[model samples]
Target: MEKFPGAEEWVPARGGLPKVAERLKDCRGCDLWEDAEQVVPGDGPAKARMMLVGEQPGDVEDKEGQVFVGPAGRLLDKALEAAGITRDSVYITNAVKHFRFERRGKRRIHKTPAVGHIVACGPWLAREREIVKPELVVVLGAVAARALLGTGFKVTEHRGEPVELPDGTAAVATVHPSSVVRSEEYRRDFGLFVDDLRAAGALLA
Candidate 1:
Protein backbone atom coordinates (compact mmCIF):
# COMPACT_ATOMS: atom_id res chain seq x y z
CA MET A 1 0.00 0.00 0.00
CA GLU A 2 1.17 3.51 -0.79
CA LYS A 3 1.62 5.83 2.20
CA PHE A 4 0.32 9.39 2.23
CA PRO A 5 2.90 12.11 2.05
CA GLY A 6 3.51 13.76 5.40
CA ALA A 7 1.49 16.93 5.95
CA GLU A 8 4.62 18.93 6.72
CA GLU A 9 6.22 17.93 3.46
CA TRP A 10 3.11 18.37 1.32
CA VAL A 11 2.43 21.67 -0.39
CA PRO A 12 -0.33 22.40 -2.87
CA ALA A 13 1.11 23.27 -6.25
CA ARG A 14 -2.01 24.70 -7.83
CA GLY A 15 -4.75 27.27 -7.18
CA GLY A 16 -7.90 25.14 -7.27
CA LEU A 17 -9.51 22.97 -4.59
CA PRO A 18 -9.53 19.96 -6.90
CA LYS A 19 -5.86 20.40 -7.48
CA VAL A 20 -5.24 20.62 -3.75
CA ALA A 21 -7.38 17.55 -3.17
CA GLU A 22 -5.39 15.63 -5.75
CA ARG A 23 -2.31 16.37 -3.69
CA LEU A 24 -4.11 15.10 -0.58
CA LYS A 25 -4.64 11.72 -2.23
CA ASP A 26 -1.37 10.84 -0.60
CA CYS A 27 -2.06 12.69 2.65
CA ARG A 28 -0.83 10.98 5.83
CA GLY A 29 -1.39 13.89 8.15
CA CYS A 30 -3.37 11.60 10.43
CA ASP A 31 -3.90 7.89 10.93
CA LEU A 32 -7.45 8.06 9.58
CA TRP A 33 -5.94 8.08 6.10
CA GLU A 34 -4.39 4.69 6.72
CA ASP A 35 -7.55 2.64 7.22
CA ALA A 36 -9.81 4.70 4.97
CA GLU A 37 -10.24 3.26 1.52
CA GLN A 38 -9.88 6.77 0.12
CA VAL A 39 -10.24 10.40 1.06
CA VAL A 40 -13.61 11.90 0.16
CA PRO A 41 -13.20 15.46 -1.07
CA GLY A 42 -15.82 18.15 -1.49
CA ASP A 43 -17.91 17.96 -4.66
CA GLY A 44 -19.81 20.69 -6.55
CA PRO A 45 -19.26 23.57 -8.90
CA ALA A 46 -16.16 25.64 -8.29
CA LYS A 47 -18.15 28.84 -8.19
CA ALA A 48 -20.82 27.73 -5.76
CA ARG A 49 -21.94 30.41 -3.36
CA MET A 50 -22.76 28.05 -0.52
CA MET A 51 -20.71 25.29 1.07
CA LEU A 52 -22.11 22.57 3.33
CA VAL A 53 -19.73 20.95 5.77
CA GLY A 54 -20.57 17.68 7.46
CA GLU A 55 -18.76 15.81 10.26
CA GLN A 56 -17.20 12.94 8.34
CA PRO A 57 -17.93 10.21 5.87
CA GLY A 58 -20.27 7.37 6.85
CA ASP A 59 -20.05 3.72 5.84
CA VAL A 60 -21.75 4.08 2.46
CA GLU A 61 -19.90 7.32 1.79
CA ASP A 62 -16.57 5.66 2.56
CA LYS A 63 -17.34 2.88 0.16
CA GLU A 64 -18.77 5.12 -2.55
CA GLY A 65 -15.97 7.67 -2.27
CA GLN A 66 -18.46 10.54 -2.27
CA VAL A 67 -19.70 13.01 0.26
CA PHE A 68 -23.22 12.61 1.71
CA VAL A 69 -24.44 9.70 -0.39
CA GLY A 70 -25.94 7.63 2.41
CA PRO A 71 -29.10 7.86 4.53
CA ALA A 72 -28.01 11.19 6.00
CA GLY A 73 -27.20 12.34 2.49
CA ARG A 74 -30.69 11.50 1.29
CA LEU A 75 -32.14 13.54 4.13
CA LEU A 76 -29.84 16.38 3.21
CA ASP A 77 -30.98 16.20 -0.39
CA LYS A 78 -34.63 16.34 0.63
CA ALA A 79 -33.96 19.18 3.03
CA LEU A 80 -32.08 21.11 0.39
CA GLU A 81 -34.89 20.69 -2.07
CA ALA A 82 -37.44 21.76 0.54
CA ALA A 83 -35.25 24.75 1.23
CA GLY A 84 -35.37 25.68 -2.48
CA ILE A 85 -31.69 24.91 -2.96
CA THR A 86 -30.40 22.51 -5.56
CA ARG A 87 -27.85 19.99 -4.33
CA ASP A 88 -25.79 20.61 -7.45
CA SER A 89 -25.60 24.32 -6.74
CA VAL A 90 -23.56 24.10 -3.57
CA TYR A 91 -20.34 22.43 -2.46
CA ILE A 92 -20.50 19.60 0.07
CA THR A 93 -17.67 18.20 2.12
CA ASN A 94 -16.69 16.98 5.59
CA ALA A 95 -14.49 18.27 8.37
CA VAL A 96 -12.49 15.09 8.18
CA LYS A 97 -11.69 13.77 4.74
CA HIS A 98 -11.34 10.14 5.85
CA PHE A 99 -13.85 7.87 7.51
CA ARG A 100 -12.92 6.72 11.01
CA PHE A 101 -14.75 3.72 12.35
CA GLU A 102 -14.74 0.59 14.45
CA ARG A 103 -15.73 -2.77 13.04
CA ARG A 104 -18.45 -4.63 14.92
CA GLY A 105 -18.97 -7.97 13.21
CA LYS A 106 -20.04 -7.11 9.67
CA ARG A 107 -20.91 -3.50 10.39
CA ARG A 108 -18.72 -0.44 10.56
CA ILE A 109 -19.69 1.86 13.40
CA HIS A 110 -19.13 5.54 12.80
CA LYS A 111 -16.67 7.15 15.16
CA THR A 112 -16.21 10.87 15.51
CA PRO A 113 -12.73 11.98 14.65
CA ALA A 114 -10.70 13.31 17.56
CA VAL A 115 -9.73 16.98 17.98
CA GLY A 116 -6.17 16.25 17.01
CA HIS A 117 -7.38 14.44 13.93
CA ILE A 118 -9.58 17.35 12.92
CA VAL A 119 -6.74 19.76 13.52
CA ALA A 120 -4.46 17.64 11.41
CA CYS A 121 -7.03 17.75 8.64
CA GLY A 122 -7.58 21.50 8.96
CA PRO A 123 -5.28 22.42 6.12
CA TRP A 124 -7.38 20.54 3.61
CA LEU A 125 -10.59 22.13 4.93
CA ALA A 126 -8.96 25.53 4.86
CA ARG A 127 -7.83 24.99 1.31
CA GLU A 128 -11.33 24.08 0.26
CA ARG A 129 -12.65 27.27 1.82
CA GLU A 130 -10.02 29.31 0.11
CA ILE A 131 -10.65 27.77 -3.25
CA VAL A 132 -14.41 27.84 -3.18
CA LYS A 133 -14.66 31.08 -1.21
CA PRO A 134 -18.36 30.63 -0.67
CA GLU A 135 -20.53 33.46 0.57
CA LEU A 136 -21.97 31.31 3.33
CA VAL A 137 -21.02 28.03 4.99
CA VAL A 138 -23.47 25.71 6.70
CA VAL A 139 -21.94 23.55 9.41
CA LEU A 140 -23.97 20.33 9.57
CA GLY A 141 -23.12 19.37 13.16
CA ALA A 142 -20.95 19.87 16.22
CA VAL A 143 -17.84 18.38 14.69
CA ALA A 144 -17.86 20.74 11.68
CA ALA A 145 -18.67 23.65 13.96
CA ARG A 146 -15.73 22.81 16.19
CA ALA A 147 -13.46 22.29 13.22
CA LEU A 148 -14.32 25.62 11.64
CA LEU A 149 -14.85 27.88 14.65
CA GLY A 150 -12.58 26.30 17.23
CA THR A 151 -13.33 24.19 20.34
CA GLY A 152 -14.92 27.11 22.18
CA PHE A 153 -17.77 27.26 19.71
CA LYS A 154 -20.95 25.52 20.87
CA VAL A 155 -23.52 24.42 18.28
CA THR A 156 -26.45 24.64 20.72
CA GLU A 157 -25.82 28.26 21.66
CA HIS A 158 -24.77 29.45 18.24
CA ARG A 159 -26.96 27.41 15.96
CA GLY A 160 -29.37 29.26 13.66
CA GLU A 161 -27.36 32.43 14.09
CA PRO A 162 -24.85 33.49 11.48
CA VAL A 163 -21.36 34.23 12.71
CA GLU A 164 -18.69 36.05 10.78
CA LEU A 165 -15.29 34.47 10.48
CA PRO A 166 -11.98 36.30 10.32
CA ASP A 167 -12.05 35.95 6.53
CA GLY A 168 -15.40 37.76 6.48
CA THR A 169 -17.27 34.62 5.53
CA ALA A 170 -20.55 33.84 7.29
CA ALA A 171 -21.39 30.48 8.83
CA VAL A 172 -24.49 28.95 10.41
CA ALA A 173 -24.67 25.85 12.56
CA THR A 174 -27.34 23.15 12.39
CA VAL A 175 -27.83 19.57 13.51
CA HIS A 176 -26.64 16.88 11.16
CA PRO A 177 -29.36 15.16 9.16
CA SER A 178 -28.42 11.86 10.79
CA SER A 179 -29.51 13.25 14.15
CA VAL A 180 -33.00 13.85 12.84
CA VAL A 181 -33.17 10.36 11.38
CA ARG A 182 -31.96 8.83 14.65
CA SER A 183 -34.51 10.63 16.78
CA GLU A 184 -37.74 8.91 17.83
CA GLU A 185 -39.47 12.25 17.18
CA TYR A 186 -38.23 12.43 13.60
CA ARG A 187 -41.26 14.24 12.26
CA ARG A 188 -40.86 17.33 14.44
CA ASP A 189 -37.09 17.58 14.19
CA PHE A 190 -37.13 16.91 10.49
CA GLY A 191 -39.47 19.85 10.00
CA LEU A 192 -37.16 22.05 12.03
CA PHE A 193 -34.12 20.81 10.17
CA VAL A 194 -35.71 21.59 6.84
CA ASP A 195 -36.63 25.02 8.14
CA ASP A 196 -33.03 25.64 9.17
CA LEU A 197 -31.85 24.56 5.73
CA ARG A 198 -34.38 26.90 4.17
CA ALA A 199 -33.02 29.71 6.28
CA ALA A 200 -29.49 28.92 5.18
CA GLY A 201 -30.63 28.72 1.61
CA ALA A 202 -32.30 32.10 1.89
CA LEU A 203 -29.04 33.67 2.96
CA LEU A 204 -27.49 32.69 -0.34
CA ALA A 205 -30.44 34.04 -2.28
Candidate 2:
Protein backbone atom coordinates (compact mmCIF):
# COMPACT_ATOMS: atom_id res chain seq x y z
CA MET A 1 0.00 0.00 0.00
CA GLU A 2 1.17 3.49 -0.81
CA LYS A 3 1.78 5.72 2.17
CA PHE A 4 -0.44 8.81 1.86
CA PRO A 5 0.05 12.15 3.43
CA GLY A 6 -1.44 12.54 6.91
CA ALA A 7 -5.05 13.69 6.44
CA GLU A 8 -5.21 15.24 9.89
CA GLU A 9 -2.29 17.53 9.32
CA TRP A 10 -2.99 18.61 5.74
CA VAL A 11 -5.72 21.19 6.10
CA PRO A 12 -5.99 23.74 3.29
CA ALA A 13 -4.89 27.27 4.13
CA ARG A 14 -6.34 28.82 0.95
CA GLY A 15 -10.07 29.04 0.30
CA GLY A 16 -12.18 27.65 -2.59
CA LEU A 17 -12.10 24.39 -4.54
CA PRO A 18 -9.06 25.15 -6.75
CA LYS A 19 -6.80 25.68 -3.76
CA VAL A 20 -8.19 22.57 -2.16
CA ALA A 21 -7.38 20.80 -5.45
CA GLU A 22 -3.82 22.04 -5.22
CA ARG A 23 -3.60 20.42 -1.82
CA LEU A 24 -4.98 17.17 -3.24
CA LYS A 25 -2.15 17.00 -5.82
CA ASP A 26 0.14 15.79 -3.05
CA CYS A 27 -2.44 13.70 -1.24
CA ARG A 28 -0.84 10.49 0.01
CA GLY A 29 -3.69 9.79 2.35
CA CYS A 30 -4.64 6.62 0.46
CA ASP A 31 -3.01 4.01 -1.75
CA LEU A 32 -5.21 4.86 -4.74
CA TRP A 33 -3.16 7.93 -5.49
CA GLU A 34 0.01 5.94 -6.09
CA ASP A 35 -1.40 4.16 -9.15
CA ALA A 36 -3.82 6.88 -10.24
CA GLU A 37 -2.48 9.38 -12.73
CA GLN A 38 -3.66 12.14 -10.42
CA VAL A 39 -6.55 13.09 -8.20
CA VAL A 40 -9.61 14.28 -10.16
CA PRO A 41 -11.18 17.14 -8.26
CA GLY A 42 -14.79 18.28 -8.61
CA ASP A 43 -15.45 20.98 -11.25
CA GLY A 44 -18.03 23.73 -11.91
CA PRO A 45 -19.07 27.01 -10.34
CA ALA A 46 -17.68 27.24 -6.84
CA LYS A 47 -20.91 28.95 -5.83
CA ALA A 48 -23.26 26.48 -7.43
CA ARG A 49 -26.45 25.69 -5.55
CA MET A 50 -26.45 22.03 -6.52
CA MET A 51 -23.63 19.52 -6.36
CA LEU A 52 -23.67 16.19 -8.17
CA VAL A 53 -21.42 13.35 -6.98
CA GLY A 54 -20.88 10.18 -8.99
CA GLU A 55 -18.97 6.97 -8.15
CA GLN A 56 -15.47 7.41 -9.58
CA PRO A 57 -13.38 8.07 -12.64
CA GLY A 58 -13.66 5.94 -15.78
CA ASP A 59 -11.03 5.20 -18.46
CA VAL A 60 -11.64 8.40 -20.41
CA GLU A 61 -11.84 10.49 -17.27
CA ASP A 62 -8.50 9.16 -16.05
CA LYS A 63 -6.90 9.89 -19.41
CA GLU A 64 -8.45 13.32 -19.96
CA GLY A 65 -8.09 14.58 -16.39
CA GLN A 66 -11.69 15.85 -16.38
CA VAL A 67 -14.90 14.58 -14.87
CA PHE A 68 -17.84 13.36 -16.92
CA VAL A 69 -16.36 13.73 -20.42
CA GLY A 70 -17.14 10.23 -21.63
CA PRO A 71 -20.37 8.64 -22.84
CA ALA A 72 -21.84 8.71 -19.33
CA GLY A 73 -20.89 12.35 -18.99
CA ARG A 74 -22.50 13.21 -22.29
CA LEU A 75 -25.69 11.51 -21.12
CA LEU A 76 -25.50 13.40 -17.85
CA ASP A 77 -25.14 16.68 -19.72
CA LYS A 78 -28.16 15.94 -21.86
CA ALA A 79 -30.24 14.91 -18.84
CA LEU A 80 -29.24 18.02 -16.92
CA GLU A 81 -30.19 20.22 -19.85
CA ALA A 82 -33.47 18.37 -20.31
CA ALA A 83 -34.26 18.87 -16.65
CA GLY A 84 -33.60 22.62 -17.04
CA ILE A 85 -30.40 22.44 -15.04
CA THR A 86 -27.41 24.02 -16.67
CA ARG A 87 -24.18 22.03 -16.41
CA ASP A 88 -22.32 25.17 -15.39
CA SER A 89 -24.73 25.82 -12.52
CA VAL A 90 -23.80 22.71 -10.56
CA TYR A 91 -20.59 21.24 -9.21
CA ILE A 92 -19.73 17.72 -10.38
CA THR A 93 -17.35 15.17 -8.87
CA ASN A 94 -16.86 11.55 -7.87
CA ALA A 95 -17.04 9.97 -4.45
CA VAL A 96 -13.58 8.52 -4.94
CA LYS A 97 -11.02 10.83 -6.49
CA HIS A 98 -8.90 8.14 -8.16
CA PHE A 99 -9.67 5.76 -10.98
CA ARG A 100 -9.39 2.18 -9.75
CA PHE A 101 -9.10 -0.32 -12.56
CA GLU A 102 -7.90 -3.76 -13.56
CA ARG A 103 -5.89 -4.44 -16.70
CA ARG A 104 -7.61 -6.61 -19.24
CA GLY A 105 -5.37 -7.03 -22.28
CA LYS A 106 -4.97 -3.48 -23.59
CA ARG A 107 -8.12 -2.26 -21.83
CA ARG A 108 -8.40 -0.90 -18.31
CA ILE A 109 -11.66 -2.09 -16.85
CA HIS A 110 -13.16 -0.19 -13.96
CA LYS A 111 -12.98 -1.67 -10.47
CA THR A 112 -15.06 -0.43 -7.61
CA PRO A 113 -13.16 1.24 -4.82
CA ALA A 114 -13.55 -0.62 -1.53
CA VAL A 115 -15.23 0.89 1.51
CA GLY A 116 -11.85 1.27 3.16
CA HIS A 117 -10.66 3.28 0.17
CA ILE A 118 -13.74 5.46 0.30
CA VAL A 119 -13.24 6.10 4.00
CA ALA A 120 -9.61 6.94 3.38
CA CYS A 121 -10.66 9.51 0.79
CA GLY A 122 -13.61 10.86 2.78
CA PRO A 123 -11.75 13.92 3.96
CA TRP A 124 -11.58 15.35 0.44
CA LEU A 125 -15.31 14.90 -0.06
CA ALA A 126 -15.93 16.59 3.25
CA ARG A 127 -13.75 19.48 2.22
CA GLU A 128 -15.70 19.79 -1.06
CA ARG A 129 -19.03 19.91 0.74
CA GLU A 130 -17.69 22.56 3.06
CA ILE A 131 -16.50 24.71 0.19
CA VAL A 132 -19.50 24.33 -2.10
CA LYS A 133 -22.16 24.49 0.61
CA PRO A 134 -24.70 23.52 -2.00
CA GLU A 135 -28.39 23.61 -1.25
CA LEU A 136 -28.97 20.21 -2.80
CA VAL A 137 -26.54 17.32 -3.22
CA VAL A 138 -27.41 14.79 -5.92
CA VAL A 139 -25.74 11.42 -5.42
CA LEU A 140 -25.71 9.48 -8.69
CA GLY A 141 -25.62 5.87 -7.50
CA ALA A 142 -25.41 3.72 -4.39
CA VAL A 143 -21.65 4.08 -4.08
CA ALA A 144 -21.81 7.85 -3.94
CA ALA A 145 -24.76 7.62 -1.57
CA ARG A 146 -22.92 5.21 0.69
CA ALA A 147 -19.86 7.42 0.78
CA LEU A 148 -21.94 10.44 1.77
CA LEU A 149 -24.52 8.83 4.04
CA GLY A 150 -23.52 5.34 5.20
CA THR A 151 -22.98 1.77 4.01
CA GLY A 152 -26.61 0.66 4.33
CA PHE A 153 -28.00 3.31 2.00
CA LYS A 154 -30.47 1.73 -0.43
CA VAL A 155 -30.63 3.69 -3.68
CA THR A 156 -33.51 1.68 -5.12
CA GLU A 157 -35.76 2.34 -2.18
CA HIS A 158 -34.54 5.85 -1.43
CA ARG A 159 -34.09 7.33 -4.87
CA GLY A 160 -35.93 10.58 -5.71
CA GLU A 161 -36.45 11.32 -2.06
CA PRO A 162 -34.57 14.10 -0.34
CA VAL A 163 -32.66 13.23 2.79
CA GLU A 164 -31.45 15.92 5.15
CA LEU A 165 -27.84 15.83 6.18
CA PRO A 166 -26.44 16.76 9.60
CA ASP A 167 -24.78 19.76 8.00
CA GLY A 168 -28.17 21.17 6.94
CA THR A 169 -27.82 20.14 3.32
CA ALA A 170 -30.45 18.13 1.44
CA ALA A 171 -29.32 15.08 -0.55
CA VAL A 172 -31.06 13.17 -3.32
CA ALA A 173 -30.11 9.72 -4.56
CA THR A 174 -30.41 8.58 -8.18
CA VAL A 175 -29.04 6.10 -10.72
CA HIS A 176 -25.65 6.84 -12.18
CA PRO A 177 -25.84 8.02 -15.79
CA SER A 178 -23.42 5.26 -16.76
CA SER A 179 -25.80 2.64 -15.41
CA VAL A 180 -28.57 4.11 -17.51
CA VAL A 181 -26.35 3.99 -20.57
CA ARG A 182 -25.30 0.37 -20.00
CA SER A 183 -28.77 -1.05 -19.40
CA GLU A 184 -30.40 -2.97 -22.26
CA GLU A 185 -33.63 -1.52 -20.87
CA TYR A 186 -32.29 2.00 -21.25
CA ARG A 187 -35.54 3.19 -22.89
CA ARG A 188 -37.57 2.49 -19.74
CA ASP A 189 -34.97 3.44 -17.14
CA PHE A 190 -33.56 6.49 -18.88
CA GLY A 191 -36.89 8.27 -18.42
CA LEU A 192 -36.84 7.43 -14.73
CA PHE A 193 -33.30 8.75 -14.38
CA VAL A 194 -34.34 11.92 -16.16
CA ASP A 195 -37.26 12.26 -13.78
CA ASP A 196 -34.87 11.85 -10.87
CA LEU A 197 -32.70 14.59 -12.32
CA ARG A 198 -35.76 16.79 -12.65
CA ALA A 199 -36.63 16.16 -9.03
CA ALA A 200 -33.12 17.12 -8.01
CA GLY A 201 -33.38 20.22 -10.15
CA ALA A 202 -36.64 21.17 -8.49
CA LEU A 203 -34.97 20.99 -5.12
CA LEU A 204 -32.27 23.32 -6.34
CA ALA A 205 -34.85 25.70 -7.82
Candidate 3:
Protein backbone atom coordinates (compact mmCIF):
# COMPACT_ATOMS: atom_id res chain seq x y z
CA MET A 1 0.00 0.00 0.00
CA GLU A 2 1.19 3.48 -0.86
CA LYS A 3 0.65 6.60 1.22
CA PHE A 4 -0.39 9.91 -0.30
CA PRO A 5 0.95 13.20 1.05
CA GLY A 6 -2.43 14.80 0.29
CA ALA A 7 -3.21 18.30 -1.12
CA GLU A 8 -2.76 20.25 2.11
CA GLU A 9 0.66 21.53 1.12
CA TRP A 10 -0.50 22.43 -2.38
CA VAL A 11 -3.41 24.50 -1.06
CA PRO A 12 -2.88 28.24 -0.60
CA ALA A 13 -2.95 29.34 3.01
CA ARG A 14 -5.28 32.24 2.20
CA GLY A 15 -6.44 33.26 -1.22
CA GLY A 16 -9.49 33.90 -3.35
CA LEU A 17 -10.82 31.70 -6.16
CA PRO A 18 -8.32 32.91 -8.76
CA LYS A 19 -5.29 32.11 -6.65
CA VAL A 20 -6.62 28.66 -5.83
CA ALA A 21 -7.37 27.98 -9.48
CA GLU A 22 -3.89 29.13 -10.49
CA ARG A 23 -2.14 26.96 -7.88
CA LEU A 24 -4.38 23.97 -8.58
CA LYS A 25 -2.74 23.51 -11.97
CA ASP A 26 0.53 22.45 -10.40
CA CYS A 27 -0.81 20.11 -7.72
CA ARG A 28 0.69 16.61 -7.62
CA GLY A 29 -1.69 15.71 -4.82
CA CYS A 30 -2.46 12.17 -6.00
CA ASP A 31 -1.92 9.73 -8.82
CA LEU A 32 -5.18 10.71 -10.55
CA TRP A 33 -3.40 13.70 -12.08
CA GLU A 34 -0.88 11.39 -13.74
CA ASP A 35 -3.42 10.13 -16.29
CA ALA A 36 -5.83 13.06 -16.31
CA GLU A 37 -5.68 15.72 -18.99
CA GLN A 38 -6.05 18.63 -16.55
CA VAL A 39 -7.55 19.72 -13.26
CA VAL A 40 -11.22 20.71 -13.34
CA PRO A 41 -11.74 23.32 -10.65
CA GLY A 42 -15.05 24.58 -9.31
CA ASP A 43 -17.00 26.98 -11.50
CA GLY A 44 -19.52 29.81 -10.96
CA PRO A 45 -19.49 32.84 -8.67
CA ALA A 46 -16.96 33.10 -5.87
CA LYS A 47 -19.83 33.54 -3.44
CA ALA A 48 -23.06 31.66 -3.87
CA ARG A 49 -26.03 30.71 -1.76
CA MET A 50 -25.70 27.07 -2.83
CA MET A 51 -22.87 24.80 -3.92
CA LEU A 52 -23.30 21.61 -5.92
CA VAL A 53 -20.60 19.04 -5.31
CA GLY A 54 -20.27 16.05 -7.59
CA GLU A 55 -18.05 12.96 -7.54
CA GLN A 56 -15.37 13.97 -10.01
CA PRO A 57 -14.70 15.33 -13.46
CA GLY A 58 -16.05 13.09 -16.22
CA ASP A 59 -14.54 12.42 -19.67
CA VAL A 60 -15.83 15.63 -21.28
CA GLU A 61 -14.91 17.72 -18.27
CA ASP A 62 -11.44 16.14 -18.13
CA LYS A 63 -10.76 17.12 -21.73
CA GLU A 64 -12.38 20.53 -21.50
CA GLY A 65 -10.94 21.56 -18.12
CA GLN A 66 -14.34 22.61 -16.84
CA VAL A 67 -16.72 21.27 -14.29
CA PHE A 68 -20.08 19.75 -15.21
CA VAL A 69 -20.26 20.65 -18.89
CA GLY A 70 -21.01 17.17 -20.17
CA PRO A 71 -24.24 15.22 -20.63
CA ALA A 72 -24.79 14.84 -16.91
CA GLY A 73 -24.29 18.59 -16.58
CA ARG A 74 -26.91 19.33 -19.19
CA LEU A 75 -29.24 17.04 -17.33
CA LEU A 76 -28.40 18.87 -14.13
CA ASP A 77 -29.23 22.20 -15.73
CA LYS A 78 -32.69 20.92 -16.63
CA ALA A 79 -33.16 19.44 -13.20
CA LEU A 80 -32.11 22.68 -11.53
CA GLU A 81 -34.57 24.62 -13.64
CA ALA A 82 -37.28 22.16 -12.70
CA ALA A 83 -36.32 22.63 -9.09
CA GLY A 84 -36.62 26.43 -9.44
CA ILE A 85 -32.88 27.07 -9.22
CA THR A 86 -30.79 28.84 -11.85
CA ARG A 87 -27.65 27.13 -13.14
CA ASP A 88 -25.51 30.29 -12.96
CA SER A 89 -26.33 31.05 -9.33
CA VAL A 90 -24.66 28.16 -7.62
CA TYR A 91 -21.07 27.00 -7.37
CA ILE A 92 -20.40 23.61 -8.94
CA THR A 93 -17.42 21.42 -8.27
CA ASN A 94 -16.32 17.85 -7.57
CA ALA A 95 -14.89 16.02 -4.62
CA VAL A 96 -12.02 14.89 -6.80
CA LYS A 97 -10.58 17.49 -9.18
CA HIS A 98 -9.04 15.05 -11.69
CA PHE A 99 -10.72 12.52 -13.90
CA ARG A 100 -10.24 8.84 -13.14
CA PHE A 101 -10.88 6.51 -16.00
CA GLU A 102 -9.87 3.29 -17.69
CA ARG A 103 -9.12 3.17 -21.39
CA ARG A 104 -10.96 0.86 -23.76
CA GLY A 105 -9.58 1.14 -27.27
CA LYS A 106 -9.72 4.92 -27.82
CA ARG A 107 -12.57 5.68 -25.43
CA ARG A 108 -12.03 6.31 -21.76
CA ILE A 109 -14.64 4.82 -19.45
CA HIS A 110 -15.35 6.64 -16.19
CA LYS A 111 -14.08 4.97 -13.05
CA THR A 112 -15.13 5.86 -9.51
CA PRO A 113 -12.26 7.55 -7.75
CA ALA A 114 -10.54 5.66 -5.00
CA VAL A 115 -10.66 6.84 -1.36
CA GLY A 116 -7.06 7.95 -1.60
CA HIS A 117 -7.88 10.22 -4.51
CA ILE A 118 -10.73 11.84 -2.60
CA VAL A 119 -8.54 12.31 0.47
CA ALA A 120 -5.76 13.80 -1.60
CA CYS A 121 -8.08 16.38 -3.18
CA GLY A 122 -10.04 17.32 -0.08
CA PRO A 123 -8.01 20.44 0.61
CA TRP A 124 -9.00 21.94 -2.70
CA LEU A 125 -12.67 21.33 -2.00
CA ALA A 126 -12.27 22.82 1.47
CA ARG A 127 -10.71 25.94 0.04
CA GLU A 128 -13.57 26.31 -2.42
CA ARG A 129 -16.06 26.02 0.40
CA GLU A 130 -14.18 28.60 2.40
CA ILE A 131 -14.07 31.00 -0.49
CA VAL A 132 -17.63 30.39 -1.63
CA LYS A 133 -19.17 30.24 1.85
CA PRO A 134 -22.36 28.82 0.43
CA GLU A 135 -25.28 28.60 2.79
CA LEU A 136 -26.16 25.17 1.46
CA VAL A 137 -24.13 22.35 -0.08
CA VAL A 138 -25.84 19.90 -2.42
CA VAL A 139 -23.89 16.68 -2.72
CA LEU A 140 -24.56 14.64 -5.86
CA GLY A 141 -24.16 10.90 -5.25
CA ALA A 142 -22.52 8.63 -2.71
CA VAL A 143 -19.01 9.89 -3.34
CA ALA A 144 -19.74 13.57 -2.69
CA ALA A 145 -21.91 12.73 0.27
CA ARG A 146 -19.21 10.57 1.83
CA ALA A 147 -16.58 13.19 1.18
CA LEU A 148 -18.41 15.87 3.15
CA LEU A 149 -20.22 13.64 5.56
CA GLY A 150 -18.45 10.44 6.54
CA THR A 151 -17.46 7.11 4.99
CA GLY A 152 -20.35 5.55 6.92
CA PHE A 153 -22.88 7.97 5.45
CA LYS A 154 -25.33 6.37 3.02
CA VAL A 155 -26.87 8.51 0.29
CA THR A 156 -29.56 5.91 -0.36
CA GLU A 157 -30.76 6.03 3.22
CA HIS A 158 -30.73 9.81 3.49
CA ARG A 159 -31.24 11.21 0.03
CA GLY A 160 -33.11 14.55 -0.03
CA GLU A 161 -32.57 15.04 3.67
CA PRO A 162 -30.96 18.21 5.02
CA VAL A 163 -27.88 17.30 7.02
CA GLU A 164 -25.36 19.40 8.93
CA LEU A 165 -21.77 19.78 7.94
CA PRO A 166 -18.78 20.21 10.27
CA ASP A 167 -18.80 23.93 9.48
CA GLY A 168 -22.53 24.09 10.33
CA THR A 169 -23.55 24.61 6.74
CA ALA A 170 -26.56 22.63 5.54
CA ALA A 171 -26.07 19.80 3.05
CA VAL A 172 -28.41 17.79 0.87
CA ALA A 173 -27.55 14.37 -0.54
CA THR A 174 -28.98 13.19 -3.84
CA VAL A 175 -28.21 10.80 -6.70
CA HIS A 176 -25.80 12.09 -9.32
CA PRO A 177 -27.27 13.41 -12.55
CA SER A 178 -25.27 10.76 -14.42
CA SER A 179 -27.31 8.07 -12.68
CA VAL A 180 -30.48 9.66 -13.98
CA VAL A 181 -28.95 9.86 -17.45
CA ARG A 182 -28.10 6.15 -17.40
CA SER A 183 -31.45 5.09 -15.98
CA GLU A 184 -33.81 3.04 -18.09
CA GLU A 185 -36.67 5.09 -16.71
CA TYR A 186 -35.17 8.42 -17.59
CA ARG A 187 -38.27 10.51 -17.07
CA ARG A 188 -39.12 8.88 -13.78
CA ASP A 189 -35.58 9.07 -12.41
CA PHE A 190 -35.15 12.62 -13.62
CA GLY A 191 -38.37 13.60 -11.93
CA LEU A 192 -37.13 12.13 -8.68
CA PHE A 193 -33.84 13.95 -9.04
CA VAL A 194 -35.64 17.22 -9.58
CA ASP A 195 -37.75 16.51 -6.53
CA ASP A 196 -34.60 16.09 -4.44
CA LEU A 197 -33.26 19.38 -5.68
CA ARG A 198 -36.55 21.02 -4.87
CA ALA A 199 -36.24 19.73 -1.34
CA ALA A 200 -32.79 21.22 -1.12
CA GLY A 201 -34.05 24.50 -2.49
CA ALA A 202 -36.81 24.68 0.10
CA LEU A 203 -34.13 24.84 2.80
CA LEU A 204 -33.12 28.24 1.48
CA ALA A 205 -36.45 29.61 2.58
Cα-based TM-score, every candidate: 0.93, 0.93, 0.97
For candidate 1, the lDDT comes to: 0.85
lDDT (tens digit, per residue) of candidate 2 on 48-152: 899999999888888888999989999999889888889998999998888998889988888988777777777888888888888899989978987887877
lDDT of 1 by residue, 2-52 (tens): 243335445374578768767878888878977888888889988899999
Off by over 4 Å in 3: none
In candidate 1, which residue ranges exceed 4 Å CA deviation? 1-8, 11-13
Q: Which has the higher TM-score value, candidate number 2 or candidate number 3?
A: 3
On a 0 to 1 TM-score scale, where does candidate 3 land against the true structure?
Answer: 0.97
Ranking by lDDT: 3, 1, 2
- Report the poorest 10 consecutive residues by lDDT, candidate 3: 1-10
Model 3 Cα lDDT, one tens digit per residue, 50-76:
999999999999999999999999999
For model 2, the run of ten residues with the poorest summed lDDT: 1-10
Whole-model lDDT, model 2: 0.84
Choose 1 or 3, whichever is better by TM-score.
3
Poorly placed runs, candidate 2 (over 4 Å)? 1-6, 11-13
Give the CA lDDT, 0 to 100, for residue 95 in model 1: 87
Best by TM-score: 3
